[model samples]
Target: MGAVATLVAGLGIATATSANAAAGCRVTYANGGQWPGGFTANVTVTNLGDRIDGWRLGWTFASGQAVSQAWNATVTASGTQVTAANVGHNAVLATNGSASFGFNGTWTGSNPAPAAFTLNGVACTGSVGQPSQSPSAPGPGPSASSSPSTPPTTPPPAGDAMAAVAAMQPGWNLGNSLDATGADETSWGNPRITEALLDGIKAQGFKSIRIPVTWGQHQAGAPDYTIDAAYLARVKEVVGWALDDGFYVMVNIHHDSWQWINTMPADRTNVLARYNATWTQLAAAFRDSPAKLVLESVNEPQFTGSSGDAQNATLLNELNTSFRTIVRNSGGGNVTRLLVLPTLHTSADQARLDELTATFTAMNDPNLIATVHYYGYWPFSVNIAGGYRFDATAQKDLTDMFDRISTTFVARGIPVIIGEYGLLGFDRHTGTIEQGEKLKFFELFGAQARANNITTMLWDNGQHFGRTSLQWSDPELIAQIRSSWTTRSGTAASDLVFSARSAAITSKTMTLNLNGTTFTGLRQGSTELVRGTDYTISGDQLTLSAALLTRLSGSRAYGVNATLHVHFSTGVPWRLNLITHDTPVLSAATGTTSAFTIPTTFRGDQLATMEATYADGSNAGPQNWTPFKEFDYTFAPDYTGNVITLKPEFFADVTDGSRVTLKFHFWSGAVVTYYVTKSGTTVTGTLA
Candidate 1:
């Protein structure tokens, strides 16, 4: 929704009169703000006669206005009458007390405030009047008896600000839950959070949790811009749970950065009011809470209508400054509460870091913390533009970023936090980044983060953690990540020890990526393999003897037959899978653009990466910049399904009637060629 240009106030007040009325109620309906086709309305109901429990405010819209979303109340519209019921935390209305709720609605020609209102079906009689002058001011909450009786005790202050933030390392994000935009927190498909889930994360060695929340959907309109008490209470509940469980928690205005905050330059007054109002409420709510809770100013703050970097930086500075002042002046523990400030989009670019450094200089607050997000090298992060491997370029990106942030913040006594760190490719699927390559990225990223003295939080978004099961999808991947926090982990150029079942087995060699750790030895289960007999290490290469491979592959299975553990002097041991496979065979098939599956006989081979190109040798997949399309985005191998699924995302990018060639790269050093053609809605595949 854009900034409202026009405002209409005091159309009419609804008066309800009945003997059965629990108490008399007066409603002030006003069009707080409006744009072209939509407007926001603020509704305040004051109980006049007596106190009422579980109140329901009802009104009839005379101008055919339809409510789309509401906060602080459960609003439902039937024909012209709209009903707003109290939520759990705000269910009681005391005598002469008031409860306020707001909603965004649509109007065609004119928006006139409703004429009459009723409380619990009894008519409320009140004269039409202008809305409150200060609508942004939060209404009177539940009576003192119904609210928390005492403020929480403040936690003792840590000696140093840098030390305080540094203690909050290895954080995990509760992503795609509260940050999801829709009816409620779980609108994004992730399950509602639970204490057990937090316990699972703690068990994994995480010290903190970053809760990203989008408060816009649950907030009322200007001028009061009040947040729903129920929503606020829920956020508080989750934060309190994490804190009580002994995990440092960080909360921030997520997604709203791009939603409404980005329009600050275009609508400074409205945007600033809401921004200030959000922090005011949050600071007030968490004021008495312990210092274990950190308040981040904003998540990936960015301005849409700004002139350039300078203007964007200035706008962001304004937000951060406002956020700090609000929290600090809000009283309670907020006076000394640690605040996190971010660069533009929370980026670690040199210019952005320097800009933030200037802000720190101006603020000169020892309690302040610098924060940024890292998603690895852009290309490798998303497996796009030919960045198919976690190679030199990708590793350099991570180091350069960590080096800059360390020098700018950590080295200067200002603690830093990588608020979110993960591979962008994980969004599509974890498999988007090849497994071995993905592991390498996380291993190096954890070590680098530790070396830089920066707290790192993994952005899970339901991919890393199995929310329902309270387990990780990939145990080895998490194991590697957890190991990197304290020490380096030994990996390899590859994790697979492939042997062709069609031919006699031979000695296989793998270049050990020691990652600064010395290789100890190789083992199977609890038995250590004898050196030279089982494997021999010469320089960086570790070669497995043919005799051992033949013994491991007793029946020449098409898949993994045995597993070998390669230990190192320090960190977690690397696991190598002994697989016996010849090659994969793809059979021709015909399907539609929406769904296309090519039957395949793996014959023991495992798919690694895929390359897609047009007949003219041009890239032919969603990631057009790379002939080697992302692993899972364009094509995925389903060994159990006995087929290769060419995803719709891949077909969506191909030209109609174009013959695209696909090369499936397998772990056994085999690449099979195939061709696919998309003709309108129909698609056909053929063996090449």
Candidate 2:
């Protein structure tokens, strides 16, 4: 017992009038396992009262201890107060029934057992139990009681691979800094990863860490490709930080772009040899390590020039096959160790993924997992700008992508990992979406991924979450991500259903009887509306405010078409189409040919009639005012509406203070005539 302690507290009887006596609860706290810097504890709560509806076990750590991962309960910590709440299924407890929940925690220099525990706001009355030996304790490692033995050579149980994949909680990627362009890790802007940083990540509720290391630049020689001894040692040291704290660790070869592993047939043999050598050494080093440590075959392997070619996909399969063969043949723990394989470019494209599934299924290795990187619909996930929102389209894309993986792989007993998934950053500059949208994305992603048996690893290039400070740059984002993982209950795709209905409104007040019980966020089209500002809700009855109702009437008068989007607090975005009898409208404007400026409010109103009168007083017919010749247009349906362009020829007709009168009919049945005056290439217009 390196830092384990067993402090027994005497049982205290509660008076009849006390809350404890009314509840009739008892709890037993015991240390399950302990290592040098961390330990696992299990708390069993017994309900002796009349039927308990729900349960929450609370305790204060005597030492400076923090919980990392917990199961059978949703655990949260604030300072010294730790609360573990029952999940949906575990909430109900009959008299004399008990439920057990366990957590892995990190402690500083000393580890002390909590003296008291409370269940459901009632003090538990029972003698605290002594620390007992854990039957599921990890094999001998850094601070184990027993000495290390030879690594197990046999494979794990048949379904162990899927089990391990499901066991992996939300993961973080130590990116860019490790997979930098050069051999120096600090060159990528992050400080050297410290044990404190790893502990901080665990304390923040992350159950796994994916360390992406580029070993190609650190290797020497040709055929042998001998990995540098110092580099290997450094990787091992960082990996130990996670392993010592009982975190599921995944290490992989990243950014080794020099090797045309899938292309260049001349170097294919040597590439295979180098891959074999790399895994051989890695498997040997961590052979005796616990099963929590996983080895990924490669990261996003692609052909030199062609990323998504069918031929390259076949080659990627070959490389993955070689990886599995080499690792399994390396003996030691490699025989049973879980290995991650990536699709071509690690793409979420269905065809490439299908090819990977066929190839991997042929390998027939139960310890193998298929991985793909998810940054679906780049504009929403990355490169986010102003007016960005997690709208219906973004929601569908994410849900559909995960559904494909679930049906294609997980349903067939093959597990998948979203190796990397996250918005670019959490700041206003990089992440322009509102905090609500970000939270919605995380919640939907986590809920869907968990339900599909897919693990999501967030990609952080050290900008969003600080590594040195041991604190999150965006605490709200971190909290949202953690909430998704902890609040997840059901494991069915149907749990996240999306539906749309046509709502009828006869008065200023409207009631929306929702299918779901709770509401998370509300939106009208792409514009997210504030709860109190736009509407009010009690149970399922949602009432629109009188002011908002007036605005809706005004929008209807202006022929605006919008939908009311509702998302349940649990998870699921449904739409209510607020159909009105108003016709749609389109608006347009012209800009100077030199630099066109489309009004932000322009709606790309289609041109019904067009005629331009030039400076000479000669009229150009409708044929001469063709839409393309007059201006170019960019339309983002359901997004930013549309943009209009002013053509160069049109600008020339109004040059040198010349005035050109143009009359146009819009699709909305509105007509307007405007005179444009130009000075050089710049043009100005006024309604005539």
- Best model number under lDDT: 1
Off by over 4 Å in 1: 1-159
In each prediction, how many residue pairs overlap at the backbone (N, C-alpha, C within less than 3 A)? 11, 1
Task: Write candidate 1's Cα lDDT for 27-116 as tens digits.
Answer: 767554554455556667877764455566778888888775454565666577677766543456666766655555667778888878
Weakest ten-residue segment in model 2 by summed lDDT:
490-499
